[model samples]
Target: MNTTNNIVPAQVIALKKQRVILKTETNEVITVNVSKGKKKDKVFMLTMADLLRSGLWIPVNRTLRQLMRYDWLDTPVKSYAF
Candidate 1:
């Protein structure tokens, strides 16, 4: 996996079953898969924390920020073993 520390501002454009489509400041559209845990098990939605940890994208617009905030509040805590 190619991971980077650089994060770019983006706007959430669409939400799929286990993916999120975002439009970046440069007008680039990207589809990201939502997952969690060390194994990267798939999930149904995206969260701000997820985007941050991804190190690739960040929600920039007001609506997306609100949604990400809601997602952060609603997410359940889980323990992962290394």
Candidate 2:
């Protein structure tokens, strides 16, 4: 398997009702998760930190480009490895 990565720019926006959204230039809303025990910003930042630490954060540009050349979309959510 080939493992490569890239980064692209995106805008992180907060919505009402404690929801966090990631909006791309193309107006794509990638993921939306609600804030649980912390502030919206804190939750979003920590979630991003986890994603980055686990190598699951992929920029939207790279995501779309890779979709054309790759057979599978990159997984940004942690998956069970056991």
Q: Which of the numbered candidates is closest to the native, going by highest TM-score?
A: 1
Instruction: Write the residue-wise lDDT of candidate 1 on 1-82 in tens digits.
Output: 3223134467666666555677777886766655545125334243433654464545443332222433434456663234
Find the 10 residues in a row with the least total lDDT in model 1: 61-70
Worst ten in a row by lDDT for model 2: 65-74
- Reference-based lDDT, residue 26, model 2: 62
TM-score of each: 0.40, 0.31
Query: Which stretches of model 1 miss by more than 4 angstroms?
Result: 1-6, 36-82
Clashing pairs in 1: none
List, residue by residue over 11-63, the lDDT tens digit for candidate 2: 54534455434555666665444446544456445755454455443444344
